[model samples]
Target chain A: MLGLSQQALLRLPWRRSLESIALPVIALTAALIIFGGFCAMAGANPFQVYGSIYKAAFGRWSAWQHTLILSAPLMLTALCTALPARLGLVIIGNEGALVMGGLAAMATGLGLGITLPPLMVQLAMAAAGMAAGGLWIMLAGALRYYRGVNETISSLLLNYIAIAIMNHLVEGPMRDASFVIKPSSAELDPANWLGAIPGSRIHFGLLYGLVVCLLAYVLIQRTPFGFAARIVGGNIRAARIAGLPVGKLTLAICFLGGSAAGLAGMVEVAAVQKRINQSLVSNYGYAGILVAFVSRHNPLATILAAILLGGILASGGILQRSHNLPDATVLVFQGIVFLCVLYSESLYGKFPCFREGEG
Target chain B: MAAESLGLWGIPLGILAGTLRGSAPFLFVSLGECLTEKSGKINLGLEGVLLMGAMSAYGVSYLSQDLVGDFWAPWLGVLAAGFSGMALGTIHGWVAQQPRVNDVATGIAMITLGSGLAFFFGKPFIQPQAPQLMTFDWGAWSSSPQVQAALKVSPLFLLGVAIAPLLYAFFRSTRWGLSIRAVGDSPQAARAMGISIFKVRLFSIMAGSFLAGIGGACLSLYYPGVWTERISSGQGLMAVALVIFAQWNPIQCLWASLLFGGAQAIGPTFQSVGIDSYYYLFNAAPYILTLIIMIITCSPQRTLSGSPGALGKSDHT
Candidate 1:
């Protein structure tokens, strides 16, 4: 019995991976309990709320379809923070990047006016979107680099400005006269809209999002440039001592982050909405911050985080319908998850079984 | 034609009213943040505090108006808002104090939590007619009804104005104020002098949040006089930038708040005068102005002129 107990305390197999996965799981379970308790306090059955969330998020292929579509944008927007975070910059400007990208794509698609082939028009719009988004975030990076401004504040402020600009365009300059009820831009040519993947309800944007996540992983974890960025993130003074081109790296990474988010915006316009409107500035950008944090800024891990959040988001409608709960019920759940996850960081390295114990 | 005729006079009067009302929230939030930051911690979660304050104030006022009478209900609401803010503030301060926790990340999470709780509990308060606090008449000299209406000043605004100079004095002379300044400028030195960094930060953050809650009351119980999900509208978040513009000085915070309020007033002022053109553009003014101010104030050469040496250290860690 003594030997068995000593063995149990000594180490666990695949200790590092197990600890990481275990900690997050524990945190998530805590979040579930807390959220359940909150629901009960708010005059609902906790079990039923959980049951409905599970049913809405994963009960059938239809729910899966909804989650998949919602997660596509989340993946791209998550990169908006994930990349900048690698350089130790806390930027929350994903919303602005997405908004600008959508506006830019709308303008490009309208300007093309079916003159080009559908595929070519799509490519042009994507390019325009990525460029606009890249430049938008790059401006924040430039401010941080040149002007010593706090990137987080600047990026957040940019989101408001971006929304204001979007409102101006859709409500004034880009407003479709016929659609007087809603402030919205003119719709794009139907042929230019992105087609769905074969036999699936999901759009071509899913492929783009997956591809970009893979590319970001390789870029941040593999390339020399990424290595230098890591070095910069680890310590700016040390990076400067090692002679990394800090300014260029900062601008380039921010641009990439913005481009990814911008692409998500283009995807939404081309795949789902087909027109720019107030709905385009949904809180996906804000949610992306939580995703990036939950994933610990690992580009590949962002996919899982996005999907989880997307599942929570997809359930918001069903929750309101079936549970008589407010739509923000999901937001409350997400917030609890975020807090639990962040707080659980302190729990790491504390478990005797996970550590190489002295005993 | 009438609105066009009233354009010049009504525009300025309307802006004055908006500024007086708008400045109250900004004043409270910035002042609260100033106190927190002055004690060497930056609470990015003030937005959440602001929202929670707004929600609680509205709910309390709505629920208590019948029991406490309308005159006293709003005051009680303001008090409840402060306590609600302290609750969230306590969460932030406690959790952020844990080792290995990033203050910035925790703050972001706190925003989600604060706003989440507000929305969750505030759903009932929406559509209820809460008792609104009375505004003091400051336009007895004016004969125009519109002018008299526009000249009405919230008592909270005057109180905020009064607090600024008082805060400036507290920072200048008091023992606790000097200690707060000491902790902010150099925590190591403060530690050597036997100050408990945890207690000071936690209390300062709570006090700051207490004020932010009052700012929220200024929103729901006074100015707009309604409870809604969208009432705060980033005003809570914008106050952080305003504090930066104020350079950690309470007196400067007052002017900065007025300037920001003036910027916000532009859109509504224009709409009131029937010059609705570029309304969206004008609404964007406060954010744009904040960005511009941050650009001018922050520098690459050295630390900001009055920035606390220990400010934001936890975020990097």
Candidate 2:
């Protein structure tokens, strides 16, 4: 009976779309319940933990500021995964691209110094960052298309190399010398720092994220280029048969993804951190991959996913303070949610809810 | 025991020691990955498996000691680590077998799940002491304590070494192994022959994860011999790259593991000599070496030449 129903479910059209919307909601609810169980096992009241998390994440205007601030980098870094995923590529080197972009941005900002106008210097920094990150990720794409190396492995390896290069520079050639306790590069001029949005504590980086995500959505969903990209992603053979530039599309999409991550790094440095240091290696890039996945690789949906994850991250400290939970409690929750999302993708079309004669 | 006695010669000696110690995790993890990839699946969550294994082994060793004796405690810890890895493997394998599931993405999700579970449970045990594995005294003939110490090999390493040849023979001579190979190389052909691709692939995956868990045990129980959150610095992840470089050959995994171990030892060896200037650069040796290996060995012309025909981007695994 179950197998017959599954076959019938596959024959329906609107049922598929309905499943996509319903499945994720059900999956997220299941994940929340599982997380509550885990919290209980860890000796905390699940309800209290959930309450604290809610209060910390979205309770007040000030709390929203923290969530939005954290969401900025996530929105950008998530693009690094979401964009390439559209081209049927799995690139997880957002961390590497971000690191290289930040490093390049730092060099460009420091190289220009106070010689140029602050706005111009910041613009140059953004360009350099995007270029570095783009090229960095593009290398993985090139390797995949040209050499047949697995993009996932190559990208992950690049992450370590980028971090290594950052560490070398910060400890050696670019060391600021003032920080005896920690290794870091020279700070950018305060005049050149990214300012907050009008009447709010949120930085301009948040605007950059929203605009970029919007542009990316339009680029992938509306533009002819996006159509071409989807064609290449949907079927490489059909793409080749249609005389589409599969290799170029693959490389370009990868470049765009990397540039998004790189911009996140630049935003982190210029907006939040005034200097390049060990603090820049925060797992924003890794977390962004989760955002991309939870959003099902949709650039626009990434906005919501990033905010969701950002709220979880913001609640980390609150959970720790109120529930005496470990800081890793947030990670546990994120991981549970991610697993649930992935598992839910498997259940599509399994449940047949066909309106009578509407099939 | 004196540092001066091993001077000048100490670098190579230290490298030998490091290679013996560090290579165990690499060997076990790669061998496990080799087994999975041989059946046309990849377990990228082995990093999480490794961490989970490390955390569980240390925790079990500490907790089980009061129930059992010291010797039994560490052994029980090893057993628990394998079972825990198998538990995760069950999840990954089940999800992987579902239609339209991307193995790469599932592997990534499994990684997050494994690490989160490990870290949440691993926090309390980080500060506690656990019993370590027994080591063999191969260097007993040498008068130098450093030489004797360097020669002490973990039994787990030998087990890995022994398993390499056995695994090679299994794939070469055993019926079940041949079935795994057929399923991995050509799922359609295997399906035509009435082989259940689902069962074979699931078994290979779970067994592979079991080995990876033991590799984690080799890490926390043997070499570093302690529980720390940062015990593994991507060894589980790198092992996958290592397996690719080894061309999925089980015997080749051993040599590649030693090479990886030497690369891992570069920074520590230099630091031992107080040459810590480029410490971070040298620390990236394994990743750099893996990338270089991939670039050199993995060209379109040669890709999957020795790999199971169905490996990477395939729906089956």
Candidate 3:
């Protein structure tokens, strides 16, 4: 069983929060063992691989910065999944939103005639990106509310459509025309670009993602709308009986989730890539789902999960370069950890220690 | 000149060919999912099963060096895929039956696992071409270019078509199929009648995944002899949509797969015709059609009722 119930966790003092961390600690240990087996299968030394991964992901300050850079988008993308999940709406359109957001941010950069200050351009890009993403998800939510379509399938279809649209635009209309091999839009001005953290390749996006996560946590856990959404997710019949505005709330939360991911997209464009390309999707949206699942939909826990997974992702290039392991080696490890973490859910209410008097 | 370029004759012919080639994988995967769903368990992991099937089939055929052609390669690949599917399904059934693990979440995870493994193995096959299956040259009967193109159906297409009536007959007449359906319709009722709901559902998921694996294998061996990471991109997931579009019937699966195939083929058709706008529209067609079909079929009046009772019966739904 998971160690602490909602009521118990709330009632416990700050000292008991340490006990709650036990689940993830145990889960992380289990993950290492499983990944060790995978390393054996791949004909690599497990200890050596582990050592290399640690060195590449966090042993150096630069590696840790890169890890945070990767973690930035994942954090917001986690919200894109986690928020709607609170309302029992599986709106998996974050990647699509991210694409749209990137397009919007790129377009803003291209279309803006006046040379504004860096802060103003960044703010405008974020707003535009979030709007594009928010609008895209709003359509899905609207269709689910009014037209009775399944959001999961529609959102997924929208992702393909968005990717195709991105491809078409970059290849045909918005293409810079000079770059023959890899078509991309005109790069944003370096003056307008986001600055990196002091002495790190990491940008301010990590701070932004963490702030969004904190805000999402408060919105989902403390706000009235969050309370109503939970009730709706639990039971629509009960929610309707309780006079909750289910349809509007669904649309609103979905929009907020989309905006979070859209912001991540803008940050990627402004901070990391500085150009919108097909590489916008490095499976961050998909990986975010695993992060959300491992965190059990709690926004704050997603930070740790995303950072942990980000470390693995950061080390993937190192593993591929050093051991000649396939880049997908990281994928296998993530898959193993994801499956084990999910399976560990069975332990939640079953543990004798968590039983009435045992703890 | 416009009329000649239009090649109106090519439209129907291409649709027919598209239906056969495109629908083969859909047909196979849907029939498998149909069986699984009939037993009251929906396994979304078929997408991964299909990917693994493609990888294994392609890997084996490439290693075999085409001495025997790729004819038997997919069959062998399907077997491996089926074995993998059964293994994954067993885990799904076990965890789901535990009353703690969520089937949908578990399925999503298994999908990632299957795809990860497929890409790991499929990395070796990015450039080298596997031995392709020999075409029967059925176009010998037709002089027209369009007709010839339409006539060249893969043997897997024929195999998938053949599976339709066989599955229909099995569902209508066979004891196991009927028991599976009974368990799906009402596990509680089936349990009352002394049936093992867990056992039936387990068998259903395994069988469903096996068929999906064959469908995946067909993509690599017959259609295009090369494998890529994106080869099975949305085919597996789209097949899930096809099951709903087919109304959970094996015969309907054929029609549904063909329709999906036609929609998919339109993108290439636009390129061949040199219609730039059509290219964009055509690319968007399948997803739009699928979304429309889902909305229409799932409408209040036409709501599907014969699906496995447990399908989508989540706490939220």
Q: Could you give the CAPRI-style class of model 1?
A: medium
TM-score of model 1 (CA atoms): 0.95
Model 2 stretches with alpha carbons more than 4 Å out: A1-18, A354-359, B1-5, B314-317
Pick out the ten consecutive residues of candidate 1 chain A with the lowest summed lDDT.
A8-17
Candidate 3 stretches greater than 4 Å from native: A1-20, A113-115, B1-16, B64-74, B93-100, B143-150, B299-306, B315-317
- Give the residue spans of candidate 1 off by over 4 A: A1-13, A357-359, B1-5, B315-317
Clashes of each: 0, 0, 5
Q: State each model's TM-score restricted to chain B.
A: 0.95, 0.95, 0.88
Interface RMSD for every prediction, one decimal?
A: 1.6, 1.7, 2.6
Error of 1 at A290 (Å): 1.1
Indicate the DockQ of the complex predicted as candidate 2.
0.56
Task: Put down candidate 3 lDDT per residue, A222-334, tens digits, no spaces.
Answer: 99989999999889889989899988998998899888888888888888778777788767777776777778789999999898888988987888888888887887777
Give each model a TM-score: 0.95, 0.94, 0.91
In order, what fnat does every candidate score? Answer: 0.65, 0.57, 0.44
Give every collision pair in model 2: none
User: What lDDT, from 0 to 1, does candidate 3 have?
Assistant: 0.76
